[model samples]
Target: MKNVSLGLALFTLVACSPVSQKNKGKKYFADLLKDVDKIQLKFFNHGDTLAESITDQTEIDIYKELITGKRDPKQKIKCDSTGEILFLSKKDVILHAWFSSRATGSKYDKACVTYSVEPESYGSALTVRSGQDIDDYYYKLRSTANRMAQH
Candidate 1:
């Protein structure tokens, strides 16, 4: 009787544990797609000076479209590997992107990607940087901001 009871108890503990099996199928960068549901853009001058920002729904939608459209759904996250900071979030969760000024073969460049997600908090808080796709997001943002400025 004791043997049966202990086995049942162990089984119950395994089933009731807080650890989740829900993430078994998840892949890296899976969180990024969900994280970008609502992103805002802001530009800085000289790396610290305020220059331009994008917050309106129209612009935000356009920016999201431009960014997500850059990659195929199956391979999008791979772009994050080599990017230089194409999608960045800063200053109250504002997203910014910048392209590298250095040549492709250079060993390193000042502009590079950094990624972080907050831990020991209520939920995941993600931060990202771009790699090779910097120009794709950066120029689009700059062009859109400039056009709005013209109007």
Candidate 2:
């Protein structure tokens, strides 16, 4: 009986030790935000043109419309007095500008503009490794950041 109880307790510990699904999702967003913050810091530190980094003309055009208020049907983004824009993506991804209103002298500030790039189709979500998801998330985050910075 003692051995059985001890084994059960050990099993419970191991099972609960893993990260919860909800926390995993939060971490995904947090990591994505961190990557964006790094990119913005690098750009500002180097005084580089954010637009030059983007190779997609469609994305560039979309960004232009977003800033100019010619496109963006949702109109979820807004620019503050400091030229910072807040953009929220359809996938619940939130972005704040480098000098956006939400940034409080922190390096990891919210993006100025945020948006999502859904893969060309509307399909069921797929489950994959954390590493793989994180890489993809960073790429998308960077693209959004570049778009907002350019405009």
Candidate 3:
């Protein structure tokens, strides 16, 4: 009788254990997707001065402010030729993109802008194209990138 009771207790304990589905690639931004339409992308252009002002450290500062709404004066980010900022979530979701000069004769030549966000689960890429008017697609990409970076 004692052995049967022990076996039953052990089985109950094992059966009641909580299973973890947090392996990897679990959707973190599931809720954020629904509110994507509400995002706004504000464009700022200081021409070459703005572009040149964005050093490694400054770029990180701007990125942090844009993404997390927190500014760290000391966090140094090494900027490359592309002037891109990359922020990765603990769960491995990537907010990877770059902004560059859109040539000399373009409408918005020296404006800094992000191009896209590539998620690990989704195979198709999301891109924000250059346009004269600020559109919903650009805002959605920007907001998604910001949320992903914060995560």
Question: Which candidate wins on TM-score?
Answer: 1
Question: How high is each candidate's TM-score?
Answer: 0.29, 0.22, 0.22
TM-score of 1: 0.29
| lDDT string, candidate 1, 32-141, tens digits | 43344344333332342223344344544444433321222342231122222233234344333332223222234343322333221111111132222333455565
Runs of candidate 2 with Cα error greater than 4 angstroms are 25-40, 44-151
Q: List the residue pairs that clash in candidate 1.
A: 82-131, 83-130, 83-131, 83-132, 84-130, 84-131, 85-130, 86-130
User: Residue 13 of candidate 1: its Cα lDDT?
Assistant: 89
Better of 1 and 3 by TM-score: 1
List model 2 lDDT by residue over 61-127, tens digit each.
3333322112234634343222222333333424433232222122322234323322111111111
TM-score of 3: 0.22
Q: Which stretches of candidate 1 lie over 4 Å from their true place?
A: 1-28, 38-41, 47-111, 119-133, 136-151
lDDT of each: 0.36, 0.34, 0.34
Ranked candidates (TM-score, high to low): 1, 3, 2
Model 2 residue 38 distance off true place after TM-score fit, in angstroms? 12
| lDDT score of residue 5 within candidate 1 | 100
